[model samples]
Structure formats: C-alpha cells, structure tokens
Target: MFKLLLLCLALLPAFAGAQEDSDWIEYRDAYRQMIWFEKYGKPKQFLQNHFRIRPRDKSVPTDGLRLTLNGKATHVALPLDALGRAVFPFSKAAYDDNAELAVNRKAGQLKSGAWVSIVTRPDGVYAAADLRTACDQLLAYLRYSGEAAGKSCAGVQFSYPKNDVSQVQFHAAGGAVTMLAPKEGPAFSGDAVTTFRVFVYRFAALPETGQVVTSSTPLAIAALLE
Candidate 1:
C-alpha cells in the first residue's frame, strides 16, 4: 500500500501537466475558431478589405485605438500596416458604438471627412491620425455595399471545439440566448430574415512564458432579425 501511494504521488505532476496542456490546446482551438468565424462567415463582397491586429505583435498594443462615439469612449486595439493606417475589415464591435455622434463631433467638422486619433497609453505613443477616415471607409463599404445590413439581429450560436470539451462560453456585447447550433446556416437560409447582427469571440491561452496561443478559429453568429 505504501508503494502504491508513492507511485500515485509521483504520477501527480504528470497528470497535472497533461491537464494543463489539454486546457491550453482547447483554448487555442477556440481562439482560432473565433477568428475563422469572423473572417469566412461574412459575404465575400462585404470583406473587401481586412483590418486586424495580431495578438503577438508588440507594435500593435491592445489599447492603440480610442473611439469617442456619442458621449462614451471606446478603446480598441486594432491591427495596423507599415504606413500606420488601420487595415480594413473591422469587426462589428469596432463600429457599433452609441457614441458615434460624439466621435464625429470631436474629431472635426467636415462635410465629407472626419478626424480620428490613435495614441498609446502610459508613454503616450502616438501611432496615427484621422482614424475616422478608415472608419468612414468601412462605413461606406457597409452602407453602399449593404454589409452593415447583414449584422443587425439577436441570437447566439455555438461553434463546437474539435476536442471533447463539455461546454464553451462565448462573450457578447449584448445579452442573448446561447443556442446549440451554427448561426451561419440558418441566418442565410433565406427565411424571412428580420434582423442581422453578428458577434465573434475567441478562446486563447497564455502560457507560462507569456506567449499567447490560439487553438481554434473564431466563432461568429448572425442573429436573425425579428
């Protein structure tokens, strides 16, 4: 019995390590799924440009972009190019803000243009200016191309992980029911669609080395209007 107890104690570390690895793998897969959903789920025409910030790039800090729409301030960490311009193809959260009016108001008064600023925190590292231009471009794409119309609904769909995880929790800007289905198939089925809003969430894991790794593609949902 004593020998058996010692053997079990010796195996504890291995078991714990395996568990940790399993968790990290699950998290990474979820993250990848979230990104995939955000990217491929959209109509190809709607995604004319791609705007994203890589999680690993030190140059693109998480709090690089600040948007003051309506009267509230929203901080966004978005990807940038070598020219310091934000890439196109933003997520819904990037533009869906109550303070859009305030952002336009504070940026500048222009007939066909607006001003936006990107300033880093703590050290106050300024990255770019006239971010509103990029936003305007995105707005134009959404408006003229009808991309925005595709994302104005209410519902939630689950994107299952590759592993045998029992449950996965997703984050959303609004409160909605979590359904056990892929949102894309039903939303695009051409059944008297009423609403069109989509949300995306990623599962990630931070290793002890401080490296963030994604496991799965991002998951996205298009809520039916009703």
Candidate 2:
C-alpha cells in the first residue's frame, strides 16, 4: 500500500528505463489526442488535459501503477496522479524519437484515453461561481467538439485518493455551510476504477451561495452531467 502511494505521486525523474515492445502504449497516439487541447483556440482556462491509462479488464488492480517513456534517447518516468493519469507531457524530444509508454507493476493489457478535468488549486479552496464556470467551460468544449450534444453542467465531482477521510464543504455567506458528502465512486463518470471517495456537489442540491473547500486535495474534479 505504501509502495502504491509512492508510485501514484512519484515525481519526474523518479524512474526511467526501457521496457518490452509488447507493452506499447504508443507515444504518437497519446500525442495526437493530447495535442488537440494544446492547439485548441477556445476558452478552457479551467480545464486541463490528462492522459489516462487503465486496465482493459475491470477487475485488474491499478494500485501503485507507474508509466514510463522509453526511447532510443528519451527515457523518463511520467508522474501519475491518484487517478492513473499524467499531465500529457508534450515533449518534442520524445516525439522526434518516437518514444512509447511503458508500465511498472503491470496489471495486464491496458487501455488509454484522454480526460478533461478542472485545474486543481494547491490551497484546496474553490469559489462557487468558479466551479460553475469550470463546468460551463468543459460543457462548451464538449459541445464545440461535437461530443456533448445536449449535455448540461449539473454539478461537479471531486475525486480524492483511496481511503480519504476528509470532508468537502460548501460554505455560504455568513458562515452557513453545507456538507458535500463523500461516497465511494468512480474517478470519473465512466472511469474503469471506482474505489475513490468522490464528493458530489450538485448545484441543484445546494445554491451557489458560498465557496467550496476540501480538507484534502482532490485527484481530479469533473463536471457532473445532467
């Protein structure tokens, strides 16, 4: 368990090496999907792109999973957050060399995808309006890209690390507070892993009266679809 935590939060340059070609999570494919967000000329200030990797089999455990880049000249460990996602490192050097992603503590055949989430604040404080704007931004991008046809931003879900015990709260004006209860839910709406403690703060459930604050940092914050 401790080892898994290390891998989840491992910093850049933590581990680097080559792996078998059979484990090819190709860099080109990741780059293509990731580059769109980088080149997108739309408003997505509140959203960030992450490359997510999960086991193809639902039962496979992903704890302590680590991703690495292996190339003739480029070798490095990609820092993965609690969600088994890494900020898609847009490296020209790795691209030119055609590097591929390798995994440590292999869980089996893996599938990869791109995810959009709200940019996290180190202070763990979120304004009520800011959360709405972030959700709105994601919905706009999804609609603009022809992904969300009639989707509406219902609320936001805050995903925390495994075994999280902190409370998420909505603080209204004059010290009134609403508890954003946490439950064992998937990291995202359709994510493969579903063991994290996710706090859902639906705008409908609570008025946008106050700011939201977390006792612990969230792994990701995603829009709640309506």
Candidate 3:
C-alpha cells in the first residue's frame, strides 16, 4: 500500500501537464470558432434570419429575465422566451435618433439630454493599452459632465482575418456595466484599418418606458450597443 501511494504521487506532475495541454487546446478551439463565425457571418446573419422579432410581437412577457443596469438600483427586465430568443430593443431608427442625439449633445446642441459615443481606436495606436487609455479618458469626460448613466462599455479586438479567429470576451457584472468583445473583421479607416470600436453608454431612459408597465421590447436600444 505504501509503495502504491508513492507511485501515485510521482505521477501527479505528468497528470497536471496533460491537463494544461488540454486547456490550451480548448482555448485555441474557441478562437477557431470565432473565426468561423466571422468568415460566414454567422451571428449577424443568424439573427437576421431566425431571431427577427417584429414590433407587433414586442410585448413584455410576464416570465421574462430581469436585469439591472447603471447601478443595481435601476431595475430592468428583458423579454427572453424559452426558444432562446432575446428580443433586443434596438432598431435602425432608434440607433439613428440616439446617435444624432449623442452628436448634438457633444456639439452643444442639446441643453440637457443623454447620449453615448461610439469611440473608435485606429490601427495607428499600436498598443491595446494605449487605445483603452483613450477610451478611458473619453469615458471619464462623459461621466464627469453627467452625460452618461452607468459605465456599460466594450472594447474592440482585431485579429488576422484568415489565419486565426477573433478573441472577444463578454463580461457583465451586477449593475455597474457590461463589456463585450468587438465584432471581428476588417474595419477600414480613411487611410488605415480601424482596430476596434469602443462603444460608451451615456443616455437617459428610453422614450416609451413611461407607458409600458413590464419589461417589453426595448424601444431604445442605445444601451445594448455595449
């Protein structure tokens, strides 16, 4: 029994090494899958085809998922059906309107309103840390001016188009804010490539929340940009 115990202890290092190798392989596979999604336009196309929820059907279901944002105090419940279909409160019109509001607010057009900025980092900025620094500065400015709600934000990550998959991480904590990986592919700058897009949330509540009681389809999806 003592000799068998010693043998098991001696093999522990080899077992640990094998586990590390397995973990690395799985990580690499995730990257590969991300690349495949980009190549075929999976998530984007899939949403367009399958999960296209109409405005008429955008009612607040009783058994929906409840979520909070801009601090845990602000309660928000979203409509998520058993079919795994999550109807996001986003539309082209809404995005255009909020984007205009954001621009006007930045240019001193609006006196008192909320708006979020689409912060883009170009390839000229080599280091990811430096790019994030720029975003952080912009975020600080928005927060100090009282133009933004909570700090729901996301950073962009660019990867080689054909060789490997994109590496994007999505993290959402309690009510502070949520961060998402950037959409993969080539974003053309005027002369260079855009590395990533950092979307900063800075908006008041949606326009139609007063009339609605429960968590209905989102009227304004500006927050979902994160």
Candidate 4:
C-alpha cells in the first residue's frame, strides 16, 4: 500500500500539466460564424468584426458591427471622426464592462488569441468617408509564419502610401501572397457584392526559446461574405 501511494504522488505533476493544457475554450458567433478564444473564461483576443452586407431593412444598424455574446446582443460601431480618423468602440474598459465571459464557456478555437488579418472593398454608394469606407484599409497581422519561400506558403501582404490611410489594398492567397490585390480576377461577383477576405495564419512561437512554428494547414478562415 505504501508503494501504491508513492506512485500516485509521482504522477501528480503530469496530471496538473494536462489540466493546464486543457484550460482554454473556443466560442463562435453563429450569425457570422467567426471564432474567438478564451482563457479562464475571458476573451483573449478582441472581438472581430466585418461589414460586407447591408440588410434590406433600414431599421437594422448597418453602419457598425453587431454580435451576440452570451445571449445578449452587443454592438461595436465603426465611426470616422470629423477629422477623418477611424474610431473603434471596443476600448479595454468598454470590453471589460460588456464582455460575457461566463456565458459561453463551451465554445471557439482550441487556444487563446488567434492572429488574423482582413481585406474589404466597397459595395454600395455611400459617402467615401463613411464608417465602412474608413475601415476598408484596416489591416492587422499578429502572427508570423516562416514559410514565405515554400510552394505551399500561405500568408497576407499589402502596400500603402507613406501618409495616406484611406487608399490601401487587400488580398488572400493559398500560397505566399505577394501582391496587394487578387491577380486572377475575383472568383465571385455580383452587382451589390463587396469582398471581405479573412486570413488565419498558422504560426507558433516558443516564448522561452524564440523559435518559429509552422503549420501544415496554416491559412484558414470562414468568410461570411454572403
């Protein structure tokens, strides 16, 4: 019986490590099908948003992005100030106040805070300085995959003027994306069609070692462009 007790004590470290590995949970929005990660039941990444579709009903708020978090509908407005600057409503304080951390503990990706980027183009005839237009050039890249030279490389790239923030380019690729826009023309099109492509770059980095991690299926995203 003493030997049995000793064996249990020896395995305690491994059991605790496994539990820590499984601490995170994924939450996905059903309406747009975007995924987010949480650690200890709080959002690790800021909320993701997009505006490629304008509902026929004018009653709906199409000027900003709306999401359903924890059974409650939350909105984040995309506004451009009079000085022609971008305005995001989700400040750290605002997020803390409204986030539904305990609501959907069972949902999202397997990890916390995914690195991603998005590309959008205009579809309708609104003012050029409108919220949607202001956000057209918003680009974010949080992860780095070190497979740019490989045949199967998948990543995002863009070019912008030194001072101009309004004019920019956006693109997606199955391999290393070199250009700012699609080269082979758009695969899909419509009279009221605006394209918003999201790229989920697969990358991993060791904080202690500073080594690059590459994924076989690195680039992925479910674009709710319809």
Candidate 5:
C-alpha cells in the first residue's frame, strides 16, 4: 500500500504539468521558421512579417482567442489583429527554453504559420509609385523563395473584415479620386474566409499616373501576382 501511494505522489507533478501546458506547439519550431525573415538581407522595407494562427475549422470562433508562450523562463501574451496575426516577437530566452505556443482554444482545431504583407500607412493612403515598388519587391522575394513561378506583379489587393465597408481609391495629383470596385473574396488565397470585401487596383487597368491610393481600414493589402 505504501509503495502504491509513493508512486501516485511521484506522478502528481507530471499530471499537473500536462494539464497546464495543454494545446501547445513547441516554441523552438516557431522560432526557427520565423527567424528566416529577420536574417534575410533582401530589400523589404515596405513589407512586414507576422505570425498567424490559422483555424482549420471555419466554425471556430476567434473573437476572443488568446495565445501565449509557455516556458520556465518566458511567458508572453500575443495579441491577434483583425486578421488573426500578430507582430512576431523575437525572444532568445523563449528559444532557449524550448517553450510552447499554446492557445486558449481547443487543440487540433488550429494551426500556426507565418505571414508577409505590405506595410500599411496610418492615414490609409499609399503612393502609386510606392505601391508599384512594393509589389515588385514582393515578387522578387517570392521568386527567391521559389513561389509564384512565371508570374509577374500585376496589382495590389485590399481586404477588409466583413463588418467593415471599406473603400480604396486612387487620388490623382490634380485631385481626382478613382474608387476601386469592391468584390467578394477571401482574405488569404485559400483555407476558408471567402466573404471579405476585396478591392483590386490593377496597374494595367488604370494609368500609372502620379497618384496615391487611399483606404479606410484594410485588414491586409496583398501583392497581386499574375
């Protein structure tokens, strides 16, 4: 009887740990994948990198989803933006601990990945010349990374949340605003979410005059390659 009781006491700590660190992926894995962007020597001043929590199940509610890094030496809460992304944190301490990226949601319902997007302006305005340059930059990186083979930078796509009726228009130097038509499309290329208000501003469709693109609140402005 005494031996059985001793065995149960030894197992108590292990059981408690399993429950505490539930629903987690190794933080070292995330660090290794995301560290590439930081080390890339390419010109990407107009771009930003984020860590995304992708819900495989479309029915999962992410309204109040929370993520954290769990480790003996590191504990940080990662806040998600409207697009389910957060500016990835670079923590050597977290890396050393081989921590866990755990979420409040149930396990096996979601996956995590990296996202690269065009940098947005606070005033929701981007210069025509700048947009072209940004698209070209993304194309170069994609090609270097062996993606979008034989494709060229065609335009830029603005995406907003379903609740936001946003607008994207080009403002000519002389003062004419041309509104880009809004259509229904997914925020990302694939994996659910096919109802965001999307607006595509193709360079070929409009004259590349000295202009600026204005927006209201775009969750993301993706580089359109074709």
Candidate 6:
C-alpha cells in the first residue's frame, strides 16, 4: 500500500501539467480563430459578443457567463434551458471602438464541470455608392468644411450604425485618408432637412492644425427609387 501511494503522488505533477497544457491549447486555438476572423473575414467581421460552451462533462449545466469589455462591468445570467449554449449581450459601443472581448468561466451550480465556446456577429455595411466619390466628399468636407456632392459619393462601405453618420469626417494622414465616426451625436438640421448628427474626426493637413473637419451629408432614401 505504501508503494502504491508513492506512485500516485509521483504521477500528480504530470497530471497537473497535462491539464494546464490542455487549457493552453484550447485558449491558443480560440485566439487564432479570432485573429483569422478579424483579418481574412472581410466583408463580414465577427464580434465576440455571444459565447456558447459544451462541457466535456455532460452532467453539469452552465451557471452563467460574464463578459468584460475594456474592463467594464458586463454580465449575463444563463437561462434555465441553456444546456450546451450560452448567450451574451453584444455591445455596439465596444464593437465600434474595436474593443477586445474577454470571457470568464463560471462555477456551475449543479455540477462540477464547465466548458464554453464564444460566438459573435459582424456588423458592417457596404453602401451602394461610389467609393471614390464618397472618399472625395469625405475628404473635401474635412478640408473645406463643405457638403459632399451627392453624385460624387459611391460604393461607400462602412461599419454598422454603431454611431450617428452626420458628424463623421474624412481626413488624410500618413499618405492615406482616414474616416473617424463617433458613437453618438446630437441631431443637426440642414437646409429644410432635419438631419441626424454624429461626430466625425478627420486627420488631414490644414493651415492651422494641419487637419480638416467635415460632416457626412444625409443619404436620401428617395433617390434610391429614382
């Protein structure tokens, strides 16, 4: 009996190391999956908003899932029917700012095991407009503080309305034009039009700050039919 006990104690370190290695492998694979989605998953980006987990041990049910965005407080309670799946709330605010998603494991109330998978959807839009024109108008607005010519805008692609469109600006920096769309804005009115407002910051060369400011003109829905 003494020899048997000695053997078991000697094997404990190996067992612990194996478990740690398994966890590391799982986390590494998950990180790689996220990176792939961010880079090659163009036209459709994924956000790590929702997470689901299927435990290796089936006797345990998920107790809950907690989400942390930039160290913010965000938590979601698991449903009674949540057996192999857990749903979390996606924050548009974090997604727009390109925030990272972090997941925390919960101790199951009913059993002694837990495992989970994370899932998220991409919220991007490809506008039916001329890309060049859109960029031109965007740049012009930033440079001269003027309105963009409607006909010039085309094939404009943007992330979802995580923010208002009116206050966004286009600017040139590091030899490339960049667009800055803020998360929220007060409403603004134009010529006979009540336009929704959003703040846009463009980086461009100006006489003063070497940067230009511009606003996005509202896209007319009626023009789509014509």
Per-model CA lDDT versus the true structure: 0.24, 0.72, 0.24, 0.21, 0.70, 0.26
Per residue, candidate 6 scores C-alpha lDDT tens digits across 1-226 of 0000000111111111122212111222233333332343222211121232333343433345333334133333443222222333345554445443333433221111111111111222222122233344333322232222233322222212333444333433333444554433211111111222333222122111222233433321111000
- Top candidate by TM-score: 5
Residue 81 miss distance in model 5 (angstroms): 0.4
Steric clashes per prediction:
35, 0, 0, 4, 0, 14
Q: Where is model 3 more than 4 Å wrong at Cα?
A: 1-125, 157-226
- Candidate 1 stretches with Cα past 4 Å from truth are 1-141, 147-151, 156-158, 161-166, 169-226
1 or 2: which has the higher TM-score?
Answer: 2
Model 5 stretches astray by more than 4 angstroms: 1-22, 173-175
- Superposition TM-score, candidate 2 onto the true structure: 0.84
What is the lDDT for 194 in model 6? 21
Candidate 5 C-alpha lDDT tens digits along 106-146 = 66666676667788888887888888898887777666555
Between candidates 2 and 6, name the one with more favorable lDDT: 2
User: Which candidate has the highest lDDT of all?
Assistant: 2
Candidate 6 ranges beyond 4 A from true positions: 1-26, 45-51, 64-226
lDDT of 4 by residue, 1-226 (tens): 0000000111111111113222211122111122221111332232233211222222333233322223135433334321111212223443444433121112221112122222222331112122122222121111112211222212222212222222122212222222122221111121111222322212111111121111212111211111
lDDT of 1 at 153: 23
- Candidate 3 per-residue lDDT, tens place, 1-226, comes to 0000000111111111122211011122222222322243212210111111111122322232221111122223334332222323323333333321111011111111112222322322123333344344434443443433465434322223332333322222222222322342222111122222322222222221111111112111111213
In order of appearance, the predictions have TM-scores of 0.18, 0.84, 0.20, 0.20, 0.84, 0.20
Candidate 4 to native Cα RMSD, angstroms: 19.2
Judged by whole-model lDDT over C-alpha atoms, candidate 2 comes out at: 0.72
Q: Assess the local accuracy of residue 198 in candidate 1 as a C-alpha lDDT between 0 and 100.
A: 21
lDDT of 1 by residue, 17-111 (tens): 12221111122222232343234333332122222112222332323332121213444333443212243323344344321211111111111
Looking at model 5, which ten-residue stretch has the lowest summed lDDT?
A: 1-10
* lDDT, model 4, position 154: 23
